[model samples]
Target: MIRTLAFLVLLAGPAMAQDPAEAAQTAAARLDSAATMLAEARSGEARVDALTETVRAYEDGLSALRQGLRQAAIRQRQIELDFDARSGEVSRLLGVLSTLSAAPTPLLMLHPSGATGTARSGMILSDVTPALQAEAEELRARLEELALLQSLQENAAETLEEGLAGAQEARAALSEAIGERTDLPRRFVEDRVSMAALVASSDTLQGFASGLAMTVAADGEAPPPDASAFRGELPLPVDGTILRRYGETDAAGIERPGWVLATRPRALVTAPAAATIRYTGPLLDYGNVVIVEPAPDTLFVFAGLSETYGRAGEVVPQGAPLGLMGGETGEVQAILSESAEGVDAPRSETLYVEVREGQDTADPASWFSAEMRSTQ
Candidate 1:
């Protein structure tokens, strides 16, 4: 955990652009806080809770590292501009020093005319030299800063690779812990043949959603958990920043009415609240979509997952492992803030979440915790 924290701190160094040095220091302090929890967890007491917290810490740290890397690239360009601006000052300082060094001390003392002239010349040089020296020191400081910035960028890049690997390992451990437990009562079992036919006939997501709702109701199974109790209090399925919020327009010129979360590659996903899996499979352009119902008139749609768990009939408690994002390196090249065009490299993995009440779209932001809402 300490190793993970260290790499994260290195990656966070560049983001505090106002004070990169201070940012690094702050990151270290934050890591210390995380480390304290890890040490307490090592006592073997509350192993499950400890492991879960550990995974969350690593996930948070990995997110910080990614943000730092993006800032580092911008800082590098700023440093180049600063170096260019200081070049003339550095050259002038060097010229002044070269001129002073050419003459011997004895010659400077005994000027061409007399002692009076020598004294006057000495006074002028003494006064001018200090100013020149000050300029030189300022230039040197900027040069040092440039070097430090370069080092920070290099270290962040290397640490990012290591952090991704460590984070993924921790995610796998958490997944196993979550998958082992499934105590939610089963409500209904989906018939594959019927579901396939319903899916084939439905022309839109809304149509499919409406049909699924009616099917669950007809089964006369016990109602799923009352997720309304968690309105604005539920946690996200994965630890990440909301890249795009409900009703936000993306660069593709399409307005999205769901929450889009940018997560690490292969990151484990969980059920935000207790729900029965209504449907789980590929849909249109959504990649792999999972529809879960936590209560009557409340259906949660999770899309863009690469691997899914549980069939259409299983009930999962809040926080149960659901699926994972795709990709090997866990690195994304573009975000919702940027256009996908010209991005030949693999983009970041995203999870699209839509909360629905009947046929109307509900704002997902109102379904998450207060702390998470602040992040959005």
Candidate 2:
């Protein structure tokens, strides 16, 4: 029975020694795919679309990597705790095995009882041996897994650095493409003088929006596309968590009629629907803002961007890049540490979304899809 147990242990050891870096490997594969996309974007005819996809790929790959690292850290901690809890039992088991291995075959076969008693001892050994072997195999597997998690963390630094660089490049390319883009339809020519005067006169977002609603399009210009069909189905313009719901008071104890989203640094912001850019620039207390008229008498206001894109009066398609959120991306070490600590990616920027119909503000939550909000 002892010999059989030892043989089983040997067999299980080799099989259980397989790498436990499956999560890390999957994340690395995603990063590699993103790199391939980046290469294709360089020469793609539709640079804007290509670069946009590339950026999303990088974001997904990095998110996967962070999650994998977090899981690994958790698994490693669990294994360590298990080992600590069973250290005494493991030591005693090892000592017993060592003594048995050193004993002569004749002595090992001899029991302190007669033949009938020896048979009973053999019966007990038969049941206990398999359980001991299984325990040994589990311990070995956990040890191997712990080692692998450490190795993955050490090697992931380079992969993360490269992914971050590629994402930055993709974003820069997308920005340049949008700036050079002239194919989008025009609804009107923005009167800079009028816009400037409105900005100077308006002290609140509602006031500004109301002023914008009164601006007329140039004669013969096309009307803004109808986005009413997309009501209750439009996706949020950016990937993020809803930090503050409509009418929720912020840290400053002031309430707003909009949804504030918390997003990662430099995350992409896109148009939720096909719309004409009514305004795109800094406004009072809001950073860079983009106000798009998605339908007649309806406007979607996006505020708090680091950099805005598209000229006012240009009609852009849905999912068109609007701007980027502010703040610098975290370094590899900081990201790894945060992952190891099992925390979410830092959302260092905020985007405020407001829906205005004529002069009254409507809840953005009603306009955006419920599923989209839950997922984000």
Candidate 3:
């Protein structure tokens, strides 16, 4: 999260120059910048870089759009409250106008009572009439301002809807670009026969992880990254709220010692650091899982992904596109089904992550950076 914030601060230079109300324009400008870079890029590597930047732009644009909408909603609510508070005053003024319109001259000059009423009428006109006119004008001005603000809010909302659609399209384009890149180094590719034998022999996830660790140990390749360096500084694969924390018990009487993040549909998943893809397949109860070996004797297991990208042996750099969360017809239903909320209730798609030391599960909250955990 710290790294991402730094990246945003560096990239949002031009966008920050504009007023908050011009969020849509700022977002459009960012997209234009990304598109220009993509057009100029020639090689596959360059295109990948361009596409990644383009995704960042889309992310920024989405953030800006959400902020604009929230502020607009607040303003709209304030306007409604103001209008409601003045309703009685407005009605009373209308009543006065109605009475004066019927017989203005006769009512002012000769009252039903007598000449004393004429003097009272003159005093009221001299002192109170001007104040009433001023108040009416002030109300009219506020109404005009409220109408303009509403129009702007509506326009911003329409733009936000259009921007959301464009963001989805951009994400698809990014995935395609990432899939085409094939220069990443491979650690080791396991033969299907051996992998199947291992899977069939293993009774549990711990057993499978142990088997895979032994296989990689035999290969004699150096460990990927230092595990302690990332003890409390690792970033999540995707932006989401941690729906289920480590050591939490579920309705089924099973305790899950990992995090289940609730992310928006089709959110991109990325690598936290350079690591070898240890295992990429389904395990018992867990959906599609991607085990990453960042260091010797340490493994990062990610579960609940809809699609697996890159080969099992590929070593991906930090922040490289790994895969995506389910859209509408994949792991979302499976995860939601396990919830006590029931199948018919609204539920978000989730990504489960577990960091393992050989076979034992580690507390992920302590592993993640303080900033990252706070946001979650």
Give the runs in model 3 whose Cα sits over 4 Å from its true position.
1-33, 63-67, 93-145, 152-161, 214-223, 329-347, 373-376
**Tens digit of per-residue lDDT, candidate 3, span 41-122:** 8876677666765665665555544444344445556667877998898889867766766766865777566788778877
Cα lDDT tens digits, model 1, 83-174, are 78877866777887887789787876787778889999989988988898887787766567657656655555455556566667666665
User: How many clashes show up per model?
Assistant: 1, 0, 0
TM-score of 3: 0.71
| Model 2's TM-score against the true structure | 0.85
Please list the C-alpha lDDT of all candidates, in the order they appear. Answer: 0.65, 0.75, 0.64
lDDT of 3: 0.64
TM-score of decoy 1? 0.67
Q: Indicate whether candidate 1 or candidate 3 has the larger lDDT.
A: 1
Residue-by-residue lDDT tens digits, candidate 2, 238-334:
8888889989999999999999999889988988888998899999998899999899989999999999989888887787788999999999999
| Deviation from native of the Cα of residue 320 in model 3, angstroms | 1.0
Least well predicted 10-residue stretch by lDDT in candidate 2: 1-10
